[model samples]
Target: MTRAPAHDLNAEQAVIGAALLAPNVVAELAGTLAPADFYRPVHGRLWEALCAMQATGQPVDPIALAARLADSGDLGKVGGAPYLHTLIQSVPTAANASHYARIVADHARRRQVADLGVYIAERAGTDTDVAEIVATGRAILDQAAAGSQWSPLIPLGNRRHLPDFPGYVLPEWVANMVYGVAEFTQTPVDLAGCIALAALSTAAGGRAEVEVRGSWREPTNLFTVVVLPPGSRKSAVFAAMIGPLLTAERALVERTKPAIVEAELAARVAGKAAEKAANAAANADQSGRDTLLAEATAAAMNADAVTIPVLPQLVADDVTSEEAASLLAEQGGRLAVLSPEGGIFATIAGRYSGTPNLEVFLKGHAGDMLRVNRRSRSPEHVEHPALTLGLAVQPDVLRDIADMPGFRGKGLLARILFSLPENTVGRRKIGADPVSEQVASAYTANLGALVMTLAEWTDPAVLPLTPEANERVLDIERAVEPRLAPGGAWGHLVDWGSKYTGAVVRLAGLIHLAEHLRDGWGKPIQAETVERAGLLGDYFAAHALAAFDDMGTDKSTRYARLVLAWIERTAATTFTKRELYRGVRSQIPTAADLDPVLSLLEIHGYLRQLNAPARTGAGRPASPSFLVHPEVHGSAGTVHGLPGWASRRPA
Candidate 1:
């Protein structure tokens, strides 16, 4: 047997050359001609078969090559005979002959390397967590999958390093330029088709040209079109999609532009008209004011006397008809003042004295009048009242009153005034008091109660009314301050209730305080603070009642039983079993009492024993650590201490 020369046995060159030739062999040179030459699929198949035989320590066989090709299913797909012959022709070239066999061996080795599985297993005898290793491995796989090199495989002929068509750029290359420009300009390009076109045009070294033209008359059915390179079938496809869209957009702008311009012009015209009208109205108002002032002066001069009516009786009575006319004529012709409240009394000069019988005069008269009064020792007091006529009752006074800063209304002021004991005195004398000191006190208490009620409801809009209601609330605050014990009114109220009542009040207070912290102050209180404040104990009591209310019968007693057991277990940790039992039995004399508290505690997890000590004979062995579970803590997990309750607890 003749051995191949050393020059005919290079490995690296063979591998590179084979890799280069593999695609051509698969595409153009596979199976059209003879078989058995080196570069042919059959040769590669035979070499692979030989390597497989070597690995298994078996003899090389042609049947094995045929079997391998049958199994791989590549022979029919790669032009079967002609492709094999063409590939085989390349095997005898002098440059390839030296490296061919070694290259085949190297290919087998490379295939083996690629096929070898890279599995990760936890290290043996190490304390490393398997979960952590698995997590890290998954993360590595994810990162590798995200990189460009790890991509889906395409068919041999379909893969290309350059553009397939002449004068055309790859879509990805054009997209990159478009995106790069968008990024550089910092302008968003949302139209995907337009962007695609722009990218294509940019890559082709062409500009996106536009033409604008105007006519003396507005253009109708206006449109725009983007002309693309001639004979570029791909460009034509892009133009077909993007051309109409851009044309429609331009047409819409042109159509709407005239309407927008007209609207702007109309707005300016309306503004000018409004300015002229405002100036005319101003002049008219000034002229009216001057005329009214002059009329008022002439009327005052004509009246013999201007006496404001002291009371309504003065306007209600009538004296002589002729005397009434003389009184109206005496003081430069002014009319008598009218009073809605029968309080104002007045005298008319040169007519009826001491109070005129104004009932007859008031019956027939319906015109503007005036009430004049002499200044008195007390500037606020109205005295020496007389009636005058022809004085215009200007609306400015009411307008001024309405415009006054912080003037709520007369009724509101009266309500506030009547709330005071001093202001209530006059009404009390008349036996017509509507609101007394007692009523005010009740109102204050009700205000506090309402605040507590609102807190329980978790309504936030309540606090905004504080500015308006603060003064009224302050009155209640002052009255209640002396009655409140150290903690506050809320604390005193809770500590003073009966066992059942105390539980209810405390629970209600807790609900209120929780809501106040959340809605009023926008914060949550801490659990430790609640426990220290004795709120937890109250919650335990309340929760028991709530559970009882829900369960409604003895069948519902299961939760209560669980809570009691937990509490007993928990109590066993801190006190002697007898002492703990005694204290519980005293507070809860009936099984009924024990059941509810227990149920509530269990439901809330507050009564549950955690790390409880084992029971010893007659008493607990030692002080066991106590764990008060969270359910008794409520949502905010805070228990506010009642006033005087903590300090009064037995040591």
Candidate 2:
């Protein structure tokens, strides 16, 4: 009394019949369904023939298929001419061939899994090392169970269509580089544009604050994160945008080196003189000791007063929150953390001490007073710290960090501007032209000049808004303030929406400075520049809404999304819980972990769990399986805000 092999006779016949009746169905299922997926030997033979005929430009009607079978000497073995007609009559409609093919493939996978299980059991019973047995077992199981967790591509309920980046809003030099990098790398301009603002922030962060209104000012520093999937070539975009800042930092260091050397030499000589005076005071008579001690103290004070400036450090890639604070103090209260990875979030989430250390980042973005007191070392303090953040990371990081202890609770997420750029992975043109030398040179020179020029400001320059600009800023504030009410459009995002106008003001400052890079101090920001910043603000607002919504998704929903991505890739129509768990074991560690994910998927209309057959005899019942929606294999519209969404073309 053994169980029959896992397969579906009806699905096999239906797929064969559909391929014979309509050639187009064969083309649709060609990628996912192979001849070996059919349960019956004759059906597999006929499917192979039909595929071969299609490949060779031959028609695949019953008569033509029979002739092909005869040529291959498989006609008599396949039950001859009558069986071909029978296959054609089995399918009621050819349009359902993809659905039938999925069924066939699913059953084939089930049979393979069953055989694999038997093989593993036999190996386990052998006189072999347990590690060897487990290793070999996992390898074969992974190969067989690769794609069972796949769910159909469907939009989550909270997903929103994001606005395109307002590349036109940037100044000509900035826009030229944004578009040029976009063209060269074939990525969205949003990435380069956001980074451009961050670069600008690095230059002018602590140097200036834009006065929005009476006693209301916004710092030029910004925290911007662009979300893209892996393989989007984000690093290339970051390097191209951040290269100028690195060059300018080196130039600034070189320009200020002589003064630094002079100050350092003076401090050293004063310290040596103070040491000699202290020794002389120790050996002097009681009356002279007091005078010599006073002199030594005076010399030590002069040495401390002759402070040597720290070398100009404009950017840092990886540093802990404490290190960032020290760098800010060393560099006149300005620092930018620019990276292509989002590991900074983990670092900020207390990766070292297991306690959240967000005081530096929290105060950095707000331009608040930051003081760091340490034992046995000089304390570090900044009257107005301006820390800029420019990061490009995979979208999943947003979901992952949402659960960190104080990331959202402390308003860290709210303070940053998020951009969810469209991923252009598979459609990118190979051997695309590189950025033109003229555009590249102009961008490098202009951005470098702006950074260096702003670094010279010893005091915060108030970039005043024109009368028209002031009115527009007021209007934006008014419009946004009401939406933050309890039942308004932005009620759920009060923290983020409350800071929208401030972000706009900061953007306006960056735009104005970029427009007049060489002589931006004491200048008024025009209404047009504010208007462009407002548009850019709107773009970020839409993306933030989408990003926060995605970040707010529960663990089960996120896991369900991973499952769905697998389903769409494999086009799987049915599977058991054990099967799905094995396929997604990395994300979903155990079968128990998959239960809630399956329930969520079922709620989202991606799957329906079928009841197990009534128990026969005293043995345990079989595992329940899910039936995937038929439309999963059909022409569903594109799903945005999900993993693997199609990338949009260049704007």
Candidate 3:
């Protein structure tokens, strides 16, 4: 695939030409133009227009000129007429002639001033005398003619050109004054005139125009250049001129050396303002990060305060000193273990008290302890025998007990109820018999009541697992019957048959039994079991028969047939060849019954005279196989089985 052009340089070139010829148009072609535009013929045409305009008396109006350009199919060739028009319109108006002249003059003057200083400094090499520097500048200017690259002069419509002058005057002929008078005599003519000259050279490039404004107090030498490339309103070339302009301004200031210190003060103020803005932004960012962190911390603390009932219990039996230390560090509080007489048995108060070792205190204490701690506040301790001991229990064990038959909360009562024998409900049930009425009543009164109370106290999702356990408990709810009804025995047998090791055969047998029971006994059984068994048996039989047939031997078939006959005889039935064949086939035996069945049918006169054989290349007999009775093969037996060697006997 052909790659499309990234930029349409032909279109850009047309716009550039239009922009350059426009009246009062300024050019700042300091750097390389787009490479494509450089090789195009349009650049020469634009240059010719500029030369023609300058050489002739007639001035070119960008609007009228652009309108005429519309006829030149070449200009509109790139299909960018609209873009070209907008670019032409952006060119500065010629009507602002004085303003344009001032800009041109200021640009040229700055260049002249810089050139004068550079020339003086170069010539003064090792000679620091101000007069020598002045003489060096004059000599350089004398060598450069009007419109020369190094000259501090601008070409003005061919009629206005620099005249030949011997020496320079202070004010009138001081247009080419050197840095000596500019620095020592403190003249404004040298600096101002140099700026105007630099502006003129820049305007000839056909890209952008520069306008300058000067201030003594603030030294506000503003250089404004319009960006070029026609469509681009901002170009790097325009921005680049700012650095040179600032440099020229500083040079002018140093040469003048006036006491107007306001410019320096203004610069200092601007610098400080910039620094203050940067500092404030940095501080605001830091403050935002700190506020976010604080909010996150508060949210984490609030979540931790709400207890989840399903939360797994800690495995530790007693809180160790390490755990206590950690808790103390986290809470920034104290832990204390005291005696009933108000004497300190063990005081781990302060940062060490609330550590995970609280279990140790519970294990040592006899009475139940009161855990008086607000969720968000410091915890206090009170001792009570029953309450304290419960805190030491494992959560999983507690969950299991709560789910036990008729057990409840209040550890003392739950323990008392658990102490009874497994068969005993409350106090009357004994042995492996059903629970007595008296025991049931007591259990309902004491254990059941306690369970109900605990259920109410706990969260719904985390209430005792008792209800779930009770639902799954196995028991004889209905009276047992002595004998199974007609369908009942078969249904139970099918279920029991599922437990047999040889699942396939047993399943098949169950199916046959169901059919026998249904047909002979006239007992209707579910049709699903019969269907499933039939399907499974057919699959097994097909596989087994295929295995035997693949053996391709009469002996193999006879042995397989014998196995099937024995099975049928043991089961007390005259096994039809089909049924006997299926049982052997279902086991995927070494011998298949298909050939044997064919042989049997042949002997039984079912099959008549067989076909002959073909001769091989070695003249040996080739026993070709053929179709037989379709009923024996089970389908349209167009396809033959294995070759029968007996069919190929010497004819």
Candidate 4:
């Protein structure tokens, strides 16, 4: 006997009723609940009508819904106008209509799982590769994880919650600038923080380093990836905030060009002198030869003294590891990579290198000594290199990088701080006055001072933590270390959590310099700055957990998810191999492809295999039958029933 699919008729009625009662409900529920989520055919059709009306920006009242349904020949099946009245009467209020929709969505998922199981059973003995079946299973599970149409790991701006900058603990100047700036661009205030951090890191450069504990000093470099949808002002925000740095670098390069030309000309003159000296030495008497060699050495020394400035490049949008290494050497190991379109991720992941260049990036972030040797070029090395990466990519691009090979396992992405704020594109009031001159002046002045401070660095001494700051650093270590320990709360994010302590110290150094340092850069960070940086660590920890959760969803369990959904929906205990195909063929396209799903099902204890005697006289083999576990419901359970593992729950 087949059990009727799980559904909440009242919830379906309430969702429809709420929408009919309040047309505005359509907007809120549109992202999470689909028309097929409704349990009843009439409810599903009615919800579809409401959505169709909403799509055209029309009112979703009774009149509009009825017209849509009647036009689609669905009005009669759903009890016409009277049924609409009954649906409207089902809801007490429209405030929780979104909640009601959630109920509908949950039941719909259960129903889908049941349907997927039928497909799994039918395809179990077929020709489909196990990998394909597993992929489909993984797809279903991914759908379930993102059932709310929002993934914390794979951020979609349409469904994220934007951070409140006014609520953030920022410098008074930054706080003041954020309101006018975010409003003008309709960007999240968090973007302000990201850009500010980058500028601060660029300012601090290789001049300042943070020593959190013994032998664990990290440069004040930051890597922030802000996820947003296309046209949500990512490029605009990036340009507005980072534009000043670009200007400063360009101006520096221009100023140095004259010296560079002079140095090259002087070097050429000295080269000719050295060549003439060498020729004279070839033919001169013994005493004359000695004099000529001495003159040549003098000329070579003079040529060396006429040094040209390297191009002043503090930030690059896209560059290979080789190029970046050279920049770090030229800029005293302080460099930034900023791209609003997220080309940097692709660049690092082999659009140019044919292999991920994460090793160089990781070394740069850690401010470790980096040595890069190219095939035909002299080996370049930098001591204490700092690479600050600021990237803004659409949700799809983030997904692409997340799917890139070796990201999660290599923890390449885990090193980055991610911000996915709700989009404010359509809601902002644009055309505000240019950023307040007072705020702009302060920001630029601070950045200029930071640049000059780096310019004044004759000695590269590590910045030591104050005694109070050292204690706070220890506290941060103690706080995050336990979480990475065995049976810890954040064991899932140990890869990221492992480095957060150092990140906090680096953040403290940046904040201290950005706020307090004026003409000089070697001052120790204050205790208050350490405390504030710890607060930021907490904030980033929350975001990291969200990102890791999405990334942690295993890739192999996909097919099993579909099979499990199908199994849960059926009331029947046993299904023969051929009989299962008949039931699930409609849901799963190819009967031959379910081999992995069914084999997985039996292997996991969701189903048990048995052989039945074949019918007489045909010398036939025994027929296969699978019995689903009686207790196989949606609660605590196992997919594989492996030893030393608890029943895995759906995320």
Candidate 5:
């Protein structure tokens, strides 16, 4: 048998009457109550009018509410001013308004659950996918629970805190520079630490590989991106850390100047001799022409054999994928793209063309072979390419690149080690001490020595790990394997976590080399070095959690952030589905696209829907309006629209 939708006429009338008698009662119920909680349409409309008037600092007595309702042509619609007084008189006292409001909201949720049952019944057998139908149904129930008085919504997933950087894990010299530069720039040490690893990658990458076990080799290359907002002095930090690499690159060029000069001169002399031989062959008689032709061929072969050396380029900035690939091929299949800005993502996202080109970035990180065939350029092939990336970019760049197609699916984002350091804006010291000259010079000399020594290797040396070190790596692998499962802590980050242990092994190799410096070739990596790398690994894992969460690792979370940003920008207290669609039309194309996004916001205490206006004999019902949470306006200490970890910033 059919029954009326769940509602309490007395409770709804009493709640409204209590608010009319005592205006301050509305403020206590701002976030928890919405007009839609009232069962009757007219009562819901009256509640909305009361909240709106109180929000503008107007009185909410019978006379004021009557005038306000009359102005909106709702006075007659809600049964005139007489009904307002009747409502005031209906409630025994205004003290129990909170209790009455909860009752009203409870009835509203009951009605929604009844409607949900009907919706599931209607969608049980249809062309729509069953999984999609189930997901939508669950979203409706979650939204209904979000509006309940007894149940408050908690954010999805485990919220983790940002861990402090393990600076001691680095070799002593590298740790000194990292600390000095961070203190000098007044930025987070995280930026300097990540860039330090990338600098080590540039020095040792492609020159060595870590043999974790038999037939399992990990390349000593890394892709690291540090995120900071503007005015954080990223350039200053980058310049301080990368200073040694630039100096070392210059020293290499200067040291190779004599060889380059000799090769160029040899090629020019051979070309001249080949020209003379050809000229003689053209002038010779038929009998002598054959012998002259042979001499000319031999001379031309000699000229071609005298190959000129290409300039050594250890670093490149602001390059497209094609340009990076070409530089790698020319530089013995090794290159590092180190930059203060993150324009490389824009290029990879197809800033030049409409289609994304991520082949080089993917293959470069994995040491996979890359064959490039461009229209007007010579064919280039890299047998084993290794590219290192060290960049400092604004926090918004992470969010922007996550939306690019195939950016995640292609494993490009997974390959990177992300660090979201605490933003230091507005808190920086006016005058901080600069890095000591002694520290600066020591860093430059040691880093330059490492780069020059590594550059001479014709074949990559396999880095051996001591028994204790190998055991430590095995322990980490065993611990990480279970977490990659769908319900584990690393479930949301399986792709990045799968490579975490490998990244630690590579870090161990770099640390071991730094410790020995001059004669690192003879040393086997120690357990202490591997332990230090593991600590650094933990630091990165915590930061990656924050970074990916900010990037909206899940599709629903990402879209929800877009919708919430719009709500904040427009200061929308109450809006219909149509209104929100128009506000975020570019990102949210149609009304249907807003379903999941709105549902997500509902789950996070951002917004709640108002009661739908009664339907007449029409094609469609009026659009449902939603009340934006008071916390969204900074009235609350933090924006509750996002998860807890998302609101946290590094101190």
Candidate 6:
């Protein structure tokens, strides 16, 4: 038989080429793969650079990359620009990325198996703890499947190269504003801070009142989540950046507080007066009573129509679904939930366990009408409620609530822009230089302007995209949909991608409004605006995928992982089904768990069944057995841990 050394150079080249052609797909592709997984030395280097660029929010374009590679003195390593060109033109389209990815991954597994055999052979004779050796082996398997593994995200600094936020540079005006934030806070400018500010500004413009669509319409409201560990300065950054918007909201309430109170008191007084007059009228003569009662009834109607303009409260931290709806209704169908507390998730999860009230929150995200009818209470109805939600929970807290029902399947969690940055704590200096007053003042003043503009926007127009901008919307769809197709590399995250295109348009509207809220739109939907939104979508999807992975890892895959660990720990290959069953019964527990996991191993080519009659007495039947692959299981003729396998296992 013709044989090769467990590597497919063609598959490696195909994967590298796919990425070179469509760099935007890097995040999803990178999740399950790494540089070391590549068989070719040059291909490994190329992948490393691709990942580096992607991780740093940098473009992976050829011209830019050629210059970078030349600077790093490694352009000659991969045969320079021509090789990159070859890789780009290797495949006809990126649609085959999943196919190429699978082929490359399969070769990577073969390579791993080859190396693992040598590793196990050497260690088999060592005096090391068998459990420790097995643990090490399981860890190697986990690395092979990083895309589906679940583990703690601690020592945040190590996450520096995890994945990148949107690499799209902000518009000069917006960039200038964010620059001021970084300058004053003396903190690394988290793009999320700016994203949060923009989302809130747009929310205030009114999600309920507007739907910006291309060929289709979607709610203007957005759900934003800036995920990071506690003490990552999310709260401080958000508080500062969002401070002006909140201030304007508070100022509106304060300015209108007196008038609202006066109107309410007047209504109460009018109600009492009407009641007294009715009582007196009841005791009077017929004509007198009728006239008095008429006057009192007219007064009551006037009082009823005199609905006091409620205080201009637009942001809420702690509130129930009913109250949030009431606020949305009262505040022109716009409100934001900005909180550092994790309770926000629980509230969204539901006040009581087992029974979740997610429909209201889901509707709020969709800008759908919410009508609450209670048997014992006044019904509350909102035709369109725009709820802009922002939460910064620690990573651990995120994992805890990830399993909440309806979070993934119902698309509640999928509709969010999730941002998780590497920790920057140790690098920050005590008593760093303070931000100059001018920049800080400008930052706050700019937000104040946005908030004021929002306040003045009594009936926020449902802005339509300009013709060219509408084209860009199509472009965004074209760009995002291919990746969402079934059997695509990103198929696992298609649900998240489903809402992503529209969300980008809504965000484009927000960015447009923020920059040119003062001046009339030159063209409401600029190409740059849509492009920026696309970049943000890409960036946020990276984080969202990472977060969602913890929640949606398949159960059988998880059990398969556990089974692999046990097999590795035992450090042996051939054994009767019952013997292996006894060893793992505690964790695997029942036949249901064991059977599927064993099958999974077989499907993955790690194990296979052996058909044989037992050497035991005639009455003793042939119990089932498995032939674990050598290197993974043990040498074919020599089963290390099980003695019966030496005689019974087929040579």
TM-score, each model?
0.15, 0.66, 0.14, 0.59, 0.65, 0.59
> C-alpha displacement of 98 in model 5, angstroms?
17
lDDT of 2 at 197: 86
State the TM-score for model 4: 0.59
The Cα RMSD in angstroms, rounded to one decimal, for candidate 1 relative to the true structure is 41.6
- lDDT per residue (tens digit) for residues 101-219 in model 5: 88988877776677667666767866777897788668667767888421223344333447767777888888899999988899988999888999999998888888888889888
Ranking 1 against 5 by TM-score, winner: 5
Residue 457 C-alpha lDDT in model 4: 68
Clashing pairs in 5: 36-611
- The 10 consecutive residues of candidate 2 with the worst lDDT sum are 642-651
User: Residue by residue across 1-651, what tens digits does model 3's lDDT show?
Assistant: 143212233343444544444443323221112111222334333433433343343455544344445645445543345644554454444344334333333333343444455445555676667785566456435422221221111111111111211113212112222222222222222222222222211111111111111210110011111101122211221222122333333443453344335445554555565555445454666657666555555554544444322211111113434443333223212222111111111222213454322332332221233444446657654332111111111112322332332222212211110000011112221332332444334322332222222222111111111232222111111111211234442233232222121222223222222223213112222334333433433332332222223222344343534443344334422233444445555333533445565455343322322345455478645332322332233322111221111121111
Task: Please state the error at residue 567 of candidate 1 in Å.
Answer: 94
lDDT accuracy of residue 177 in candidate 6: 52
Better of 1 and 5 by lDDT: 5
Per-residue lDDT of candidate 1, residues 1-651 (tens digit): 042211222332343234233423222222211111233333434343333433343443334434455667856654454444444444444344334544433333332222121223323235757775566446444422332011111111111121111111212332343333323322222122232332221111100011111211110000011111122122323332233323433443465567667666665555555555445455656657666555545444434133322111111123353344434433222223221111121232113344334432332121113232224422221111122211111112222222232222211111110000001111112322232344334323332332233322211221111232223323333543444456442333322222222222222222223234224333332223222223323322332232222223342343344334445445432223344445445223454545454445434334433355577689536633333432233221111211110121112
lDDT of 4: 0.69
Candidate 6 residues lying further than 4 Å off, grouped into runs, are: 1-163, 166-174, 177-188, 191-195, 202-215, 351-354, 373-377, 429-431, 456-458, 519-523, 553-651
RMSD of 3: 55.2
User: What C-alpha lDDT do the candidate models reach, one value each?
Assistant: 0.29, 0.81, 0.29, 0.69, 0.82, 0.65
Scanning candidate 4 in windows of ten residues, the lowest lDDT window is 642-651
Question: Over the stretch 480-599, how does candidate 4's per-residue lDDT look in tens digits?
Answer: 878898757677678888888878888888777666656335577778888888877776776666555444433224345445545655655667767766656644556675776677
Query: Compared with the true structure, what per-residue lDDT tens digits does model 6 show for residues 95-196?
Result: 788787777777666655554555567688999788876876674565445432111111111112345544335544456656555545555455445445
Identify the candidate with maximal TM-score.
Answer: 2
Poorly placed runs, candidate 1 (over 4 Å): 1-43, 46-158, 161-258, 277-651
